[model samples]
Target chain A: MERIPILKLHDLLLVTIQVDMHDRLAMTLQDDLMHQIRRTRARGVLIDISALDLVDSFIGRLIGEIASMARVMDAETVLVGMQPAVAITLVELGLSLGGVRTALNVERGMQLLREGSPEEEASGHASIDH
Target chain B: MPASTIERLQVACEEDLVRVRQRVRTMAAEIGLSLVNQTKIVTAASELARNMLKYGGGGETEFERVERNGLIGLQLTFRDSGPGIENIEMAMTDGYTTGGGMGLGLSGSKRLVNDFAIQSAPGQGTTVTVIRWK
Candidate 1:
């Protein structure tokens, strides 16, 4: 079973989707992400989809679910680097991803996570207390 | 002087879905389609393939490079030999779904292509064909 690598950058967790995703991999990433969020007690999650060229309803729903799950577990999710064509097709497919925030790239996503987190007001560390 | 080639694939499970998408991307790129065009067709393929897996239990997909009326096109046909859709009009409805899906599979795939057609009967099977031009 291939797992999506999760990188922890201080208080933000980043998962860049570099491979073309399948249903199982998508589901696995969802589970792994949830566990990492709770274990790390992170303040934000950044999912970079720059490498993903195609996204369907299942993958789209998985993404939305990740955002919702992360929110429930006390974190904000920012999705970045969606391709123009993927964006167009997703809108037509009726998956709005209302729960997740959008960013242009990973750098911007990192900035958003840092600024959006409530813990950012403190010692630059979004610990379990927040 | 190049000859049109066709590729066939099975869309039965999760892995198949990914393979079909990858195959479509390669085929579309080979046809000299733009990035946006390639992505559109691949996304549409994913939706239709999932529909076939969920509703029809499994299906076959065919890809062929076509040239019609001076338009170079990539066409895909998905066929399922399972419980066929009785009402395509209702199935094509934006919010209508037989399975636990958004019901955008058929309609969305239709919108992403230059040409679309479907043939099915209650007991026969379902065949959805779509073409995107480059």
Candidate 2:
């Protein structure tokens, strides 16, 4: 089986998961990713899902949970490069990411992370500064 | 034989998921969907089957072939006599799962298919229908 690759860049973590698209693997990876986020105290995370062909409810929930856990650890989680079909399917299923952020690609996600600080957003400074 | 047919599948908790997967896969393939679409349908069925076993108190799944606008499609209905959802709106909301379900099961399954519907009332059981077109 192909492994999901995790790469650390600057203060962001990039995870390139192979398209196993299996619920069990997705859940396990979600757990592992959460652990990594907590351990590294990273500021941002970009999950590349361009390779996945399918994502069910279980995997979607795992992603949502990862986002929530990342938030508690003061990290921002961004899902990037989701296929159009996958996006449509996720919407049709009525699955929402709660507050997890999403971007079209990793570059955009990283840019978003760099542009804003947790204090600026949390303290309402960015909103006011803009 | 009619162009479309509906068959009632037995419910046996988690064991029923295997049957649901097999039946949905066969139906999805028969409709000429691509491998990706087939996988989506199978995943949807698995999620629903697990839900049926976990919350719906185990019921029946109905598989049918449908045609609309000259296109062939696969339709599935899951019905259970378990405790019905007290709040359909809340139940459909993401992150509002009462059971251990990842809370994405219903919504995610809805996304995988072309048409989705859910009907439930407290003490009246629950029914979910999903359709996929080729």
Candidate 3:
């Protein structure tokens, strides 16, 4: 077990997950983050995955699902700091992340969320476009 | 290294996915895989395990270490005796998951690892092998 680190910003919340990106932990974190969104009604979310070495279909789908749930709650979700290899693999595997927003880094994602409109941020639709 | 270092794990149904994944993670780490490699192996294993439980009924997972040309790698084999796939080529195609959820498991898992192989027939079963080098 590891200490899950979460940071709250003005309107965006950042979660730093330290555990290996396995199915159980990913699903648990996704559930907890959604619960937090429903409870706090935060405007946006930034997931810092620079520490994550791998991103698979299950985790990718879970992230997309959480983003969709957040949208229903009127919040936005952005995946930040994806590794180059992970990004390429996700694209190659055809994991459809239709409605989820992504950024090169958390700082950039936060800036995009702060500057972009809800409509733009809400673009993460639940489709397997890939 | 000795063959004793290799670990074999078995699980039944979706309930055992977590345990199977944990076992694979531990073995991957013992092989000295980097964080990135570890993530890829774990995710790939999860995708296969899910398919085994959901589509294949139940199955066994084996974890072993392989060395080639002075390089070490981790190998995982997922085998199930459930209903086999009819069109393996089509199933490998993107967005073609028969069970649902974006249908990204096969293709996604393939891309996450260094080596990927799948064997299946209508009446037999499905066997998937994935490997990643350290």
Candidate 4:
């Protein structure tokens, strides 16, 4: 019944995970983000997990799935603002979060998304950087 | 040498699982565990609590403040009375799951703590105990 709000910033979708999400809540977030992507036709997704104190394998897998799903929808997903302790714990927990792009913070994540695909930029789409 | 009971919780659903993690974090911090250690213990608690709820059909968690050899530590015990695991070895192996999960709960949680123990059988339920020194 509870939902995490997804904000749309132009061609990007911004999500800040501020609560200690339950399993169903995390699953709902994944479902909601996918639908929003299709509806808004966003080009990128920025997920801020800075507020999350713990990311167990369930949440970790959902994040990976969200990234993979977003890629299939032609959108980039960047995870941002992981705490140093969380990063260490995640590695020890044996979750590499492989194939998920990450940034130090929201600003860097937005910049990474704005940079566009390497091939797209190489083809002179760099001038359209917003 | 002696341990003090800190808190006890009933973990039956997602909300309880969140409470388990938060309580573990708070207790870990109260015992002066470093930030990294607190994160590790809390993550481990999250994994084990979810396993109890999902696979074990809910369970009980007990937090203890333990002192061994003059070192203060936090100890957690999770007990469940649902369907017991048939093969704990396979379950403890990474990427092994009977419940359509990533299967990192048991094995991964073990790695995050200093001491870990588990007991289960085909008909009997499961009990997992872990301790992290500060």
Candidate 4 C-alpha RMSD relative to the actual structure: 1.6
Which pairs in model 4 have colliding backbones? B1-B67
- DockQ scores for all the models shown? 0.66, 0.23, 0.32, 0.92
User: Mind giving the per-residue lDDT tens digits that candidate 2 earns over A17-110?
Assistant: 6654444456667777777787776778889887775556766777888888888887878988887766666666666666778888888987
Local error of candidate 2 at A116, Å?
A: 4.0
Ranking by lDDT: 4, 1, 3, 2
Residues B1-134 of candidate 1 have per-residue lDDT tens digits of 36877789998788999899989999999989998889889989998888888888999999999998788989999999988989989998886997877778888788888899999889888999999999
True contacts kept of each: 0.67, 0.47, 0.47, 0.98
The TM-scores, one per candidate, come to: 0.92, 0.64, 0.73, 0.95
Model 4 C-alpha lDDT per residue in residues B10-30, reported as the tens digit of each score: 997799988898889989999
lDDT of 2: 0.77
Report the number of the highest-DockQ candidate. Answer: 4
lDDT of 3 by residue, B1-134 (tens): 55545566676754577777778778888889876677677878888888888898888888888987788888899999999999988988777877876777787788778999999999799999888988
Query: What is the per-residue lDDT of model 1 for residues A34-127, given as tens digits with 9 covering 90 to 100?
Result: 9999898888999999988888888888898899889888788999999898998788767778878999999898777766656555765544
lDDT of each: 0.87, 0.77, 0.78, 0.92
TM-score of chain A of each: 0.89, 0.82, 0.82, 0.93
Q: What does candidate 2's lDDT look like per residue over B24-63, in tens digits?
A: 8888888898776777777788788778878988889999
Order the candidate numbers by TM-score, best to worst. Answer: 4, 1, 3, 2
For candidate 3, lDDT tens digit of each residue in A1-130?
5335557676567886544654556777877787777666677888888877566677788888888988888778898888876676567667758899989987799777776675654785321222
Higher-DockQ candidate among 1 and 4?
Answer: 4
**Model 3 docking grade:** acceptable
